[model samples]
Target: MTHWRKRYHFLVQITAFSLVLYSCDVTKPYANKQTVPDHLYGDAAADANANMAVLSWKEIFKDPLLQDLIAEGIENNLDLKTAAANLKAAEANFVQSKQAFLPSLSGNASAGAYHPSDAQASNTQVYQLYALSSWQADIWGKLRSTKRSMYASYLASEAYQQAVKTQLVANIAVTYYQLLAYDEQLNIVQQSLEVYSKDTETMKILKNSDVVTGAAVVQSAANYYAVKSTVPDIKNNIRQAENTMSLLLGRTPGPVKRDSLFNEQVYSELSTGLPVQLLANRPDVKQAELQLRSYFEQVNVAETSFYPALTITGQAGLYGTQLKNFFSAGAFLANIVGGLTQPIFNNGLNKQKLKIAQANYEASEYNYSKVLLTAGQEVSNALYQYQMVDEKAQSRQEQIANLEKAVHFTKELLKYTSDTNYTDVLTSEQSLLSARQSAITDKLQQLQAVVNLYAALGGGWK
Candidate 1:
């Protein structure tokens, strides 16, 4: 009795010691250490809460065909599917981590016979069946920290998937806009071809009548060929744009149906909200922060690995020489054990693990900060580009109008007066063509700018 009492007292003392260490072994809560600037959008923004990203992608794109393309890309883009697979994998790992808190049980049964070579030796047979269970107590919070890390990783994967979706939508819209621009440019080139062909014939008639020299006829023919040469290149551009949009939609390379560039309705209010909204709006930004969170939990896990672990194990079985007596009380056997294991030396492995985890945590901090800054840069750049293109629209239209008049005036002078020669008419006609094509390009830029701004503000993937 005295011996049993002493053993119980020793166990009580050990339990008390473990309880005292519990406070220090508790895992720390995660905190957001990243900072946001007062003005993330720079000087290009107006309202504090007018972000266009809050609107659905349909609201911004407005074209039925474009909305269909975005929906198709979101459903079929390979990269987004891959991200989704990764998210599922992370979720599985998180579930496994949670299961670690439960005990494990195993069962086994065996029958064996032993025979000796000597004549006097007799054969012996034994039969036994047993069940065993073991559980590790989370005395140092290591399991808890690991579970938290896996949870963070799962969230990061979800955010990464969203980021891919947002990017894919933007790419499809931009490529479609480029196709429309190419179509419009092709039309302008064909119109100029018609005008130049007429001028070429006019030059020949005037030369035969001696109103203008052969040089005028040669110049008109050269300009006609010059304008005709661009058709193939513009058609090639349209084909390439179509192929790109096809890939985005996960389809074979083919023509993409689209509306006219001039028909696109421009959203008057491109409201970029405050910079701080990026935390909630940008999936890539959220992904980076979640990665940082996972690494923080990993650091905690590493810290806890330096402490001791508590474990409990038990087993119960039936043992008897004869199979018929296996159910007897005398054949029953049972045992249990409880202990603690502390790592005293492991060739500096624990210290190395801690150092690596710390380094990873520090690196994630810098990466998270970099992602946040890049998000702000994208928003600012898109907003500025949209404004720049909008401002240029008026001037570009005026310039095209003036060049058309110049072409008309110069052609009339060449026909009725000697003040302007063939060279002046050719120059004015070339400028008019260039300006018309540039006007189409300007509209394309404006439309793409809005798409970019919407994406930069994390508009898609709702």
Candidate 2:
């Protein structure tokens, strides 16, 4: 009884010490950056709250076909599905962690026949049954830390799924527009071929009348064929871009119907909210932060491992020499045990775990910082691109106008000219063709910049 009492007092004192250690949490809560930029873009943004990142996918991508494609991607994308599955598993683990401190109960039954060596020994049957229970006390907050870590992991997986979703939406929009641009280019080239053929006929008439030489007519025909030769390549590129869109929609490679490139309007309200918003809006950044959170909790768990563990175990059951007397009072049996295990030394295993956990926590912090910097850089790049293309689009329109007039004037001059060289007409036509193609590229760039801005601001997931 004295020995038992002393052990009881020792356990009580140990429990008190454990309470003290629990309060001294080695891992601290994560802190935000000391100086987060006010706006993602370098310059001041008016009404930062009026950002397009708040807009939903339906609002940003106004094209009906694109909206439908985004819907299909959210529904059928394999990466999102995988992330969701991982989230489910994490949830299960978290729930299990919540129950870790609770005792476990189990039952068992056994029968045995044994004989002792003697002149006339006989076998006797012994039957036993037991209800066993055990529990571990989480005095050092180990189980709670596990629960916290698991919950963080579950949230991280959810963020990963959202990241995948945002990426898919952006991909579908970009590919659809690329296909449209290719379609427009094909039309432009075909129209140029028609003009070239007409010019070739005029050149032939001039040659017959001795106004131009046969070499001029031949040169005109060659230029017309040169423009015509580009048609097949443009058609192939358009087909491939369409196929890319089809795959994004989780369908077999095929055609994707869309509005003409000229007809598609840019996303409305290209506001790039505050840079601080990236913590919540950018799923990759959010996931990285949550990963930091999980590792932080793991540090606490590792720190707790250096302490002692308290456990209580018990077994109560019925046993007898014969089944007929199993219910007798003598057959009733019960036993209980309590234990404390302090890891004095184990080849530095606990220290190693602590080291690993601290290193991982630090790594997570670094990764989170990198994600923030990357988000800011991308937003800045998109904003600059948007401004550049927006300005160039106006210039492109003016250039297109002047080049049209040049083509018209050069054709008239060639029709009645007594100039030494007819090369000016050919040169003007070539310039016009190049300018028209560049104009198309400018418009496409303007539209593409909008898509990139939306993504950089984390616009699609919502």
Candidate 3:
């Protein structure tokens, strides 16, 4: 009884010593105290409509081909795939972090044959089996704080994956629009070549009649050839565009079949939601915010490291000399132990780590603000560009109509007499061709502007 009392007293003293040495403050940083901008970009609270910025991607992009391509890119784009894998890895880390509060168990078994001098003892076999367990108790909330940090990191990784999805969708849509623009340009060039070829034949007749010198005919022929030369270049461009689109689709270079670019109509009216909503709608902004939260949690974890850790462990096992008797009740044995650990004079490593974590948290805060600012700028720029392009497209349409009428009048006057020189006909033809090309370009620009706005609004990844 005296020995047991002594042992109890010793255990009590050790427990008290450990408690005093390991006692530390585990208070978490005040979340509500961390103030962020109320509005991410422009004044959101002032504009109630900004809250309705979460429009679906389908409503934003009406092009069927564009929607299809975005879907394919999401499924097959390598960057998006890698981001998804990274998210999975982060989730695994979070799971492991949560397990830190749980006990770990291990078992060991050993058997050995020993031989002694004949005069001392005979040979014998000895067998031993045991189990060990360990656990780190979160008395100071260190493990829980670390687990929360990991959870935040996991959420951040998921946000990053969404950001990747958004980017892939935007890229695929832009590429698709680019291909359509190339098609429109090719069509315009082909029509110009046909008209130029007709002019070349007419110049030949004029030269034969001595109405024009060979120089005029040569000039007309040169113009025709010039227009014809553009055809091969346009075809080359088309092939390259196709190859690029194929690569974006995660496939080998191949022909991309599509309907006429002119037939594809894009929606003209668009709603430019207020910029502040970008914080919620833009994946990159959300990702940055999530990363900031993760950093804050990490700071909490680092601060908690200065506190004490409590652990309780237990193990049970059975052992016997014969294998068949290993499960016998008499061979059963069990033991349990509890402990507390405190860091003492660790050469300032923990202090340095806490400082690093605080610095990192500050960095993340700045990054979040930077991303928010960038998102606002993009939205503003896209809105301005879209509005400007729409006006330009309207003006180009009028210009094309007037140029077409001028071309027809010039051709009619040239057929009647020499009152209007062929030069006038050529000038009008050139003007009409230029106007048509400009109109097509304006249309392409309008489409590109819409793509830009959709991307800026984070409308691609639903």
Candidate 4:
């Protein structure tokens, strides 16, 4: 028996040696692949630190109402809640992965009775109690790499949660602002309708007194009806906007109370810190980078699988035929085992798995790059939109001023001249009303552009 044991040991050593040689031939497909660039913004020519994005949510949105809504969204929004739960789940997985590197200990106990039915046979009772332990020696760094991969995944989930929070805050703010803008537009339309109705009444009196023709009265009445028709449509829009805001707040559709749109203050000078800081500041970008890092660790784990895994196991137990004898020292039993397993053949499954891991790693790298590029594009687009809206607001404000003057002058001219064509008056009124509505829309655009810019720069949810 001793000679046979020695021969078995020798064979095990030879097998281990052969596995090491085989491992030397196995290599990762992405082992030589270069890491993806950390920054995709192409704006790296500036001061390395100058492009960093920074804006606390409080500072970015100074409005108390908006800040309150954002806070509510963080607390109650279902998407954000799901994201938080996912982060917790990832953290739990990371803990389990880390535990793989430690030894596992367990205890066991058993009690039973046995009896024999024969001439001169006697009944026997036995009891047993013991403990067991096992641990894998991660000499190949497989467990360490797996734990690190899980840690990276945990961090990625956290980043994803942050990204969700950022989006939630931005969406709530934008929707709330939209509702306010609709309110302002509705008010403007109502006021325009009131003015037109009064003008229609005055034109009717003039026609009855023969100061204006029946055709003039009809034109003025048509203008009044046109302005009045817009009121119900604007009201419907306002209600829809309110419903949208309610849904974003994670509540049933209902009324949304807000401050006047004109009263809302938006920052005039939007200083977008820099482009290079997006990698660290943008939650989506950070999430992608973490996913890439996780994949990198996965590649290491895959490479380590080509090497042999050493595991040690032990089992100790106490057994007794009599239940009360389970605690007795005579009932104690124990065992210990150690093994080294190296993949010899599995129908090419291991190799295929490695290839799949390599493909996933490459895909993660591409996704990271894509995320960075998309973030940069969004920031650039938002900045340009903010600038365009800022310019448009200025131009529209001037246009509104001119239209106001035209309305006043046309009204005055109508009062002084008996031959003043009511058609001309109606034309001027409609143009002025159109210009005023455009100005209100431009104001909303300017505000929304600010919201978009802040979101793109990853400024909110800080």
lDDT of the candidates, in the order given: 0.87, 0.81, 0.72, 0.75
lDDT, candidate 4, 281-359, per-residue tens: 7888888888887887787887777778777677767766777666777666655566779988879877887788889
**Candidate 4 stretches greater than 4 Å from native:** 1-53, 116-123, 319-332, 415-420
- Model 2 stretches astray by more than 4 angstroms: 1-35, 44-46, 119-122, 420-422
Candidate 4 — worst ten consecutive residues by lDDT sum? 25-34
Q: Compared with the true structure, what per-residue lDDT tens digits does model 1 show for residues 248-315?
A: 99889987889998999877688878777888988999999999999999999988878878876778
Write down the worst ten-residue block by lDDT for model 1: 14-23
lDDT of 1 at 349: 89
> Tens digits of per-residue lDDT for model 2 on 1-462?
696688667667755765665575544555544345565457746355678877898887788987888888888877778878988988898889888867999999999989877876687889999899987777677888888899899899888888888888888888888888888888889889889999899999988998889989989999999998889999999888877777777779877768888888786567776788887788998899889989989999998898887777878999998998998888988766767899998999999999999999989889988887788888888777878878787777888788888788877877787764457777878888888888778778777778787887777888
How many angstroms is residue 295 displaced in model 4 relative to the true structure, after the best TM-score fit? 2.0
The true-structure Cα RMSD of candidate 2 reads 3.2
Residue 313 error, candidate 1, Å = 1.6
lDDT of 3 by residue, 210-324 (tens): 6666776777778778777877887888888888777777878887666666776776656556555666677887777777777777788788777666766666787666666
Candidate that beats the other on TM-score, 1 or 2, i.e. the better one? 1
Question: What value does the lDDT take at residue 236 in candidate 1?
Answer: 95
lDDT of 1: 0.87
Model 2 Cα displacement at 18 (Å)? Answer: 8.6
